[model samples]
Target: MTTPLLGCDFSSAPTRRKPIVLALGTADRGRVRLERLEKLESLAAFAAWLAEPRPWVGGFDFPFGLPRELVEHLGWPTQWRECMRHYAGLTRPQIRETFAAYCDARPPGGKFAHRRFDKLAGSSPSMKWVNPPVAYMLHAGVPLLLEAGVHLPGLHAGDPARVALEAYPGLLARECIAQRSYKADDKARQTPERLIARKDILHALEQGSTRLGLRLKLTHAQHEALVHDASGDSLDAVLCLMQAAWAAQHGAPSYGLPADLDPLEGWIVSA
Candidate 1:
């Protein structure tokens, strides 16, 4: 039997308004099926979920580490574990102030430092604590993975059955629709145009048209749920879920990450 795969749309401060979304499924022969999509109502709930020992791979939508440039500039530890330890100890305000100072010292268009993987994956700078607040996401999420002793491929090898990968739904979403918005957290901002974009993305995934060569098999209810979720959390979870499926298909030595990946700055899966 194939072990399950999961995709998480994480939030630093999860509440009923912006809960973490989890897509649970199984993959077979390049096809992935959706079993359920679970919404974790709080960060505590998310931590509890990871405590269960399970055989599964998950693509978590959060940066696993800071850029090497940022780490070195701060004179933090160069090792991944030590760097994470130092980073996790800081308050959010301290992080913001430090990052802002770092950015302010740099020239325009290069204010924020980047990891090699961020450029390849077309992801936002991991240090940005606002907008997406991914810095806080890392602050909130990475510790949980570390505590659970989950395998992080190149970064920190642990349980093979419970692999954790950095994933960005935007990388895969751009495969179908470039520069088009698909989700909005605010109910009023969920527009019809974005709804159409979501459908287009779903159609592409179902047809196995992307580079991954995997088709998504969703039940009628599942399809409707993905479409009706104007926040795009469900679809984003599905995208990460497919990434996990693709990684599993290859028996990914580095979980579909490049061989030359930086252990300090973790790579995004299938980027």
Candidate 2:
């Protein structure tokens, strides 16, 4: 039997208003089926779900590692596990103060340190604390993954059956729609244009038009559910699902990650 697959659109601080979304599915050949979508409204609930003893591979939309340059400059632990343990101990304010100070000391053009993978994936630096607040996301999320003891391909050794890979939904979304805005958190900003973009992305996924060569199979209701969420959380989860499918189809162990990936800075799968 093929291992079940999951793709998560995570939130560092989850609540009923904006919960973490998981697109649960299974991939066969080059086609991926959307079995269901799950929303966890609390980090505690998310942790409980992660601890469930099951065999599956997941693509999670969170930075699995920080920029090595930033870590070294901060004098944090060099080893992946040790670094994460240290990071997990800091308060969000502490993180903001430290990262902000580092940015303030740097030149304008180079305010934030970046991982090599960030450039390749066009993702915000893991050290960025605001706008997207990915820094807080990393601060809140990675520790939970580690606590769950899921295997992080090149980074940590854990339960091989329960594998987790760092995923960025933007990487796959950009492939379909370029830079067109797709979804918005603010109701006023969730314009028709963004809705149309969501449709376009779904259509492209259904048709397998992107570079991954894998099609997404969704039911009629599933199709509507994904397009209607103006926040794009569900759609983003599905995008991560497509990425997970590609990685699974490409073969295991590395799951399409580069062989030379930085051990201290985990890579985005399919980047």
Candidate 3:
């Protein structure tokens, strides 16, 4: 019996315009055969998926916590689980007001507090609300994972068979195409060029040419489906799926993290 790998592209508020995307598959030796991709309509739906009986290892694209500096400055709990509990309790307005106050006190360049993994992986600051709104992603997503009894490897212990790791698809995508714009949420912006880049990315994965050393096997229909979604949600989910595959292949003896991982700020796998 092979273990399943799941990758998720999350949204704080999912609608028909943009929904939470999931990529599901299993690793066969060196190849990851993509079985299906699904778009969940609501947080309730996403939560139901998490609570399902099938044991899965998933790479979820969301910040697991705020930066250590930010947490310390605000006098929030230093413990990871404790911090999340505190965070999940606060209302959205309370959160925005608190973060806004913190940013206002700092200088322009150094205003945003960043996790160590943000520096290493070049991810958006977990506190940023405007650009990617990953702050909301964490608020919306992580608490559900906690409620579902999913184990977050180094951060939280739960059902060992139901593992969840923080993943940033951009980390893998950038390796294949150095910051080249490959996706846009707007229908008008989905150009031929971005489609070609997606093709290149798909090809690279199929050829077993990534640092993770795993290839992607997809049926003709699946290949078309991955490319047809110009929004890149599907592709992002697959990138995360591959990252989960790497962690599965490696297991979590190290929890697929650096030895010096901060308990206050969880590390992003393959960052």
Q: Which candidate is the best by lDDT?
A: 2
Give me the runs in candidate 3 sitting further than 4 Å from their true place: none
lDDT of 1 by residue, 29-90 (tens): 88899999999998889988987888889999999999999999899999999999998999
Decoy 1 TM-score against native: 0.98
- Lowest-scoring 10 consecutive residues by lDDT in candidate 3? 250-259
Flag clash pairs in model 2.
Answer: none
* Candidate order, lDDT descending: 2, 1, 3
What is the C-alpha lDDT profile of model 3 across 81-101, one tens digit per residue? 999999999888888899999
Q: What is the TM-score of each candidate against the true structure?
A: 0.98, 0.99, 0.97
Query: Which residues of candidate 2, in runs, are more than 4 Å off?
Result: none
Q: Which residue pairs collide in model 1, if any?
A: none
Model 2 per-residue lDDT tens digits across residues 15-126: 9999999999998878899999999999999999999999888899989899999999999999999999999999999999999999999999999999997888999999
* Superposition error at 258 for model 1 (Å): 1.1
**lDDT scores for all predictions?**
0.91, 0.93, 0.90
lDDT of 3: 0.90
Q: Give the TM-score of candidate 2.
A: 0.99
Any residue pairs clashing in model 3, and if so which? 252-255
* Model 2 root-mean-square deviation: 0.7
Error of 1 at 259 (Å): 1.0
